[model samples]
Target: MLRCNLICIGKLKEDYWRKACEEYEKRLHSFCRFTITELPESRLPDNPGKAQIQAALEAEADRILNLTANTFAAALCVEGEPVSSERMADLIRTLSLHGTSEISFVIGSSFGLSDRVKEYASIRLSMSAMTFPHQLARVMLCEQIYRAFQIINHGKYHK
Candidate 1:
């Protein structure tokens, strides 16, 4: 089974987000063993300075790096390459065949991923250049992951 991890900063507190995530998670079981890990987000005052944001992101990056020590890392960033569901499925298939036991997708907090975190990534994947709340990003990622499985298996969900 493919071991896929979603490492994100902060908790999903909204009921709708939680429910959405749960639905995709249940569907993901047929594709991969999914692990969702939450890292603490720094509590900064409103209108934080650039330095403050950078520090917070650095702290979050450290947590992510520590947790994903033995897994292939994919950093979610606006500047990264955006791949199609079929392409992502093909990538997953290749990784499975090549003996990649685990894969981690890192989603940063409000200010986005730190430079160090981006450097740590084996691949930088972008859902889009447009900004979205981290909570929505998680739900979107989960759905796409499940969709990727459908594409790989030639399931009707992909049609």
Candidate 2:
């Protein structure tokens, strides 16, 4: 099975978000070995400056890079290219065809990813041009991965 990893720099503290992620994980089991790696988010002050945020992002980036070292990392950021469900499905299929069985999707903290993380990514992906809470974004990414697999397997779950 293809290994799909969702590596994020924060926890889904809310019950609803956790449930949503669980649902997607259960759904993805048959399609792939879907796993989530939640790393700790760096703490920042109430009015942190650019340097502070950059420092935190860089610190978080170290952990993210270590986790995704062996996989084809895809950093999820606002500046990334927005991909549709069909394109996402195709990307996975094509990657597997080319012997890339593992793909890691990284979602950064509130300040977003560092330059190092983005630069390390094989592809930078964006769900939308609009902003979303990192927790909600995690759920959306989970759902999209499920949808992508549904498309890949010609499953009826996707409409």
Candidate 3:
């Protein structure tokens, strides 16, 4: 089975979000060994400057890099290329065949990811053009991953 690690900033504080993530994690068991590692977001003032945000993003990137080392990393960003569900499934399948069974998805905090992190990614994936709350984004990514696996397996869950 493939091993998927979600290295995301910030924790799920809401019950609904937690439940939603747990549900997808459970569903994904049949497809991959899924794990979520939440890193603490950097604290910032009410009106943080551009330099402050950059510093925070760089700090977060350092943590993400350590966690995702040696894995096929996919950074989630608004500027990333959009991919269809079938395309995502094909990418995963191709990666697996290349001996990259461990895939890591990197999600940044409100400040977003640093350029270095994005540069390190094998692929940069955009869930959509619009912005979403990081917590909701995490759940959305999980669902898409599950859907991708289902599509790959030719399961009825995907239609």
C-alpha lDDT (0 to 100) for residue 64 of candidate 2 = 94
* 1-159: candidate 1 lDDT, tens digit per residue: 999999999999999999999898888887889988888999898999999999898888889999888888989998889998888888888888899999999999988899999998999999987888889999999988888888888899987
Cα lDDT of all candidates, in order? 0.90, 0.94, 0.92
Question: Which 10 residues in a row give candidate 3 its minimum summed lDDT?
Answer: 127-136
TM-score of 1: 0.96
**Cα error of candidate 2 at position 50, Å:** 1.1
lDDT of 2 at 123: 99
In model 2, pairs of residues that clash are none
User: Model 1: which residue pairs collide?
Assistant: none
* Better model by TM-score: candidate 1 vs candidate 3: 3
Residue by residue across 113-146, what tens digits does model 3's lDDT show?
9999999999999989888888899999999999
**Each prediction's TM-score against the native?**
0.96, 0.98, 0.97
Residues 54-139, model 2: lDDT tens digits: 99999999999999998999999988999999999999999988999899999999889999999999999999989999999999
Highest lDDT: give the candidate number: 2
- Candidate 3: segments with Cα more than 4 A from true spot: none
CA RMSD per model (angstroms): 1.0, 0.7, 0.8
Q: Report the alpha-carbon TM-score of model 3 versus the true structure.
A: 0.97
